[model samples]
Target: MKKAEVVLIPIPAMGHIVALVEVAKLLVERDDRLSTTIFIMHPVLDPSTTKYTESLAASTLPDRMRVVNLPNLESNTEDTKDRNWLNSMIESQKPRVEEYVSKMRTQSQLSPDSPQLAGFIFDTFATGMKDVANGFGVPWYVFSASGAAFICSMFYLQALHDGEGVNLTEFKNSDALLEVPGLANPLPAKLLPSMVFREDLLAIFLEHARTLKETRSILVNTFLEFESYAVHSLSNGKNPPVYPVGPMVKHVADGRDLRSDESNKYRDIMEWLDDQPPSSVMFLCFGSWGSFCGKQVKEIACALEHCGHRFLWSLRKPSSQKGKIESPSDYLNFQEILPEGFLDRTLEIGKVIGWAPQVDILAHPAVGGFASHCGWNSILESVRFGVPVATWPLYAEQQFNAFQMVIDLGLAVEIKMDYWRDFLGDNEIIVSSDDIVKAIKHVMEEDSEVRKKVKEMSRISEKSLKDGGSSFSSLGRLIEDMIDNIS
Candidate 1:
């Protein structure tokens, strides 16, 4: 039997790269005839992302898998707020990718032992590679790091603007609900992604949605049981085939953890959790980019003290640089931002730290609930561990994910559905301590319906990965389709 290789192109961010690589690993494990090569496009500002790629390249991969780092391109990320920065950065890499893949094709043609190119699998933002796949005459797929509902919402947004001539910017302040396919409830206009407020961002976003129609398939990092309505809606043959082959979270049981290193502080966190009682602690972590102004930090401090729950908070200092994707860093002194006497008063009941072993902590018995930014990966991780989330979305498509959890799925309690971070200043409304306290209490309630729902879904999420389950079957179909397209 002839062997084949699939090329993977993921955005340089940690979250995107990790998810797509899991898909590659699964593909190779499931079929002996398949192999994968992940092309890493380095991010401009974050050294952490580049470092992660280095570690992955150094690690022992499966028999037929490899990670290739493309040559670094010097680029400016100073105007990151302009919305054109990401699109421009991704577009600029086209020549490098084309040249590399063109060379791979030539090498395969010369050697009979080399694996033939099977297909191109790209992260949704990297869809600019469509033309290269076209030139090479191979099928290309778009892998959504988000859920199926997000993809459906993207399609709906594009249709509303181009087909119906609806002005999307109006949704920023309008008290209207958006009725779209795939969601069980009518989506509040305010919960739409922040990109809708700006024409420049919206144009780039809609272009990606439009490009999905031209792909061979869309592979979402969600399971069928998780997003049945959205998956079924997209599979109606009007769009390309949609495959839900995930809930692709790290298996803590497999000894893989997301902690940065084996430092004493990281070790102390897990040890502290071990001392606490089961389902007693509220774990608060925003994603890598999540941070807040001093005033907001104080409000969260007030709530944590008032609620008096056993808490583990991963608090990061906001980056001082303006208009850049530089990730927030750890504060040297917690006293500078936190309220006076707050730390002393709650010292025994709470533990505040920078960065977290999120997968490890969630898997621990002591974690009762998660106060989260509702990043799709975080949502999946929380669900996998049966940890109910108190949604406090910061930006991007997180507000939509929060809404889906609270309104459509009834799987989480709401903190605030539409919280957009203002990197310029604190223009957004402040979420009061009272609201935070309320959400924490609701999520931690032992008999709460949301908690029950999450526990049940956790079982389903696990089952979906077993031999004959939903995600397992979807993955099988995706592999079969890719093999069938081999020329």
Candidate 2:
């Protein structure tokens, strides 16, 4: 049998691209008959995005793999000032992607393995892959960068056929608790993803949900055991098989001793962890795009100070109109944005940095809890390391992810919120320092039920990732399915 020439297309961001690169490396390393190539279709060009692509390409990989950073699509736009612009940008990028796929198909026709272009393994956000797969007459696999729960939520669209989708924004103002069929928890609509709340985005989701039937298979970055109900529900009668191959980070781990003289930048974080007491440090990071206003920042800082726990916080410099990192001269100073004397006072117990090695920090013995935005990737990484989460879902599917974490899976806890009273009060309601302080204490204190529940989830997480475990077996099945389908 000849090696299948598999092409990979991932979403534009650094994190998404890195995961796809790792998956391509794994496939090539596991099968001698597999050769992989990656086509990075970035929709925009900026300093950070450029650096992300370069860094990803620099990462270690199998010799048989190749990576291509393609030119930005002509239809892409930089106008993110309005939400409508963002939606238009996504819609416009499709034609440019179609053109690129046409060129790739033409090039593949010239290869020695001319007719063996195999199939496409595409990021979930790259919806244009369906058309590309149709052009080449090959199967298309949908790769989800998040957990199985996120994927299962889309299946609820079948219920939307009966009536209008649940309007979370309206529910947030009313007393109604939105009941999503097939979900284990009956959650308030305010706790749902923004897409589910906004009508325009809800339409987009419904369209995508319908597309699931066209997929050859769906691959999630999670284990079946961790979200067995979700995986089972989505796979029940679907044409596309749902494969839970995950904790995807494990595939990228080079398990030498943590003290090895490896030149990786994460080495410094590991060294710092060695000095802290067991489970004493809180790992604080919101995913790449999560941002907060100056007021929210101050409240978080105050909460951290009140907790009196050792912590490592990743603070990002906001971007200016020209897309450059805002300088100290712009707006308020960092100190002003933080609570009064919070940093100086907590210097003995906490360390604040612009960025840290998140995965390494979570795996450290000193790390007791994760204060996160509940991004799917971050949540999965926390689960993999047995680090309990203090979920503060900022946007996107994060609210839904947080709901599953606390209510469904009992893996973590969410900061309590009274949506009707808070956001729709007689006066404008705001989150206060008191709420933040209470939530932090609940997640970090040893006696709290939230902490105990997370500890139990951690044990289950360990078993899910072990050899011959759910995630491990799912990965093997995915590989075998692809190999068997190759002509």
Candidate 3:
């Protein structure tokens, strides 16, 4: 029998791409017979996007895993912030993705013993792989970059919206909560994904929900210990096999060593951190797509000034000011986005860089707390390094992730679960500087529950990847199943 060569497709965003790369690396690491080729399909809106792909190709990867670039697709503008826009981008790439994979299959057929594509795995947005796999008679799986809870909610959103007559727009202001299947709690409309508002986005999610049910299995980047109820909900009935092989940063963090980030430019930041006391500094960073409006950035600056603790903020250009940003480095101009004297006020207590070496900063002993956008990958990284978090969700299903971390996992405290409240009109309520300061103080407190819980989770994250651990054995089962399908 030939080895199983799985093609993993990730949606173009930085977070989605990074998660798939890590999972692809893990597949190659755990199974000798598994070979992976990841196709990165990015829209060349920025030179930096292409540069990122090239960097991934250049990274030190396992011998069995390789990264390849898919040709850039046409960028879409309308509904750009809407989840539907991303879904449409992925759908538009289907023809090319299929053509390329079919060509690879045909070429590999010439070599009798060469590893053949026994399976297809697409991350959440790339669930378009279901049709590609079906068209060519190959098994496929959906690898959600988020927790099982969000995946489950997405799977059931349309039913609640259409069949249950839940008016999503009305629910935004109402007291109704989504009684989604598989989730233990009633999710407030504010906590639900933004897809509920528009019929087109709901349709996209519903299609993926249907596609997922037809797959061989579903994979989530969360551990069983962390999401037992949600995982159980997904595995029940004819929902396909649900594998909880995650807290993925453990497999990808290079054993929690700060040297994993080799970028030389951030050495000064690390050196500055070395002077701080252990677990004394706070770190604030949203994801690559995460940026605050000018109003929010100023509020953050005020928060840092009032907190009076050593902090490192990875500030990006205001997402609200999209058209004004002409270059990738525009966010580096703090003076432009920040208020006069704001930098001076916080200079003594905080360091604001355009971007910080996140993994390295979190791994450092001196850094204690993280104020995060609740991107699933960042949450896993924070837990991996035992850094407690202040959950500050900005958009999409991030609010759900915040709930999972703060209420379900006890690993993080909430800065503002409904951080997007102001997103509609830009005047819901500025999470006051006082509120931000309190949240950070709570996260960094000595003997805090968040700290203790995160430390324990760090140990569990390490253990879950070793032999006989749930993730380890689950990965083994996944490989064996893929090979079995081939034979």
Candidate 4:
């Protein structure tokens, strides 16, 4: 039996690495003749990233699956604010990756029976490593940690900018609607990714979209039933083949070793939820990097207090320090941010904590609604668990994700469709308590159409992983393609 190895390069963020690692595990587990090596490129801008990598490196993985941590480079404080920050950071690691791959190639050459390095699988942010994959005469693929809708949006925006000669900067406040391919409805121009309005940052992403056209395939973390129209749009035969193998969300049991404080907090949350009625609790959690200012936090506290729903809220302190990735951290004291007596007034009906066991909480019968940042993983998890969502997007492609769910698919209620938290402290829009209360009411309503739709989709999401389902067949195809190329 000939063995072949596929190399994975994932951005070091926990959210990005978690999904990629799950896919890698799925790949090697599905094929005995295959193995996977994941290369971790530390962002060097956030300590949370380092902690996550260390945890993942220490975890027990499946057979023939290995985690490799690259040597960390010194942090460059200047690029954190530069338009080219992400690109420059990724580019600096290329030489080291190249050297490592070259050594592996030499060792394979020297040995007669070792697994041949067959291909490169890159995270969306790590596409800069494509040149190194090319240097070895191997095909490179993209593992889209986001959904098909976002990838489709990227390509369409690229075409709109290059072919149609539109000034994208005008889109920041434009009232025009765009007929993007993946979305079923016309997209509001203002709801497009916040980066599209910035020329410098737009240049970086447009280049990524161009490079993606050259890949062997793009494995999107979405199922066909969820985004059939969007998936169909991407399968137009002009670009690389796309495979929808997802809802690749982590399970409640699949967690890292939590600190003692985290463990205690999680236990308390579950205990509180276990006492609540089925489908009675509303969960408010942003993604790993999601956080807000004191003003917004107070607004949410007021909203939660007014809504009168049994709620579990994960609140993190927004990063104020310079040169660090603007991720949120656990607040040492909640009173510093929340309104006075807000916690006491809502104490019987709500629980606010620093970090949440999101999956576990969602899986619990008490959870009926999610007020999420619309991160793809969080969206998938909410859908998978039959919980309706009230979208409160923060950054990246989240605003668009919110748009797709509310307008295109009618699967979730919406708070705001264009709220991008500008980390430079320019965020002026504050979603009022009244609007949040309305969305919460809509999501928790038992007979609401969105709730019905999410429940049905949750059932479909389960079947998509079974035999004869879309995601299962898609993953089988991806594995066969790799094996056939190797043979």
Task: Using TM-score, give the best candidate's number.
Answer: 1
- What tens digits encode model 2's per-residue C-alpha lDDT throughout 353-462? 66556777787779888888787878877877777887777657777788888888877866643321111112133456677667666677775676676666667766
Segments of candidate 3 deviating more than 4 angstroms: 44-48, 74-88, 250-264, 319-332, 339-348, 421-428
TM-scores for all candidates? 0.96, 0.84, 0.90, 0.95
Backbone collision count in every prediction?
A: 0, 0, 0, 0
lDDT of 4 by residue, 311-429 (tens): 99999888887445566789899888889888888878988988777887888899999999998989899989999999999888899999999988999999877787877664688
Candidate scoring better on TM-score of 3 and 4: 4
Model 1 TM-score (2 dp): 0.96
User: What lDDT is obtained when candidate 2 is compared to the true structure?
Assistant: 0.68
**What would the TM-score be for candidate 4 when compared with the true structure?**
0.95
Residue 201 lDDT (model 1)? 82
Clashing pairs in 1: none
258-327 in candidate 1: lDDT tens per residue?
A: 3444688987898888899999999999988889888899999999999989999999988786654568
Local accuracy of candidate 3 as per-residue lDDT tens digits, 435-487: 89999999999998789989998888888888988888888888889888778
Clashing pairs in 4: none
RMSD of each: 1.8, 4.6, 3.1, 2.1
Pairs with backbone N, CA or C atoms under 3 Å apart (clashes), candidate 2: none
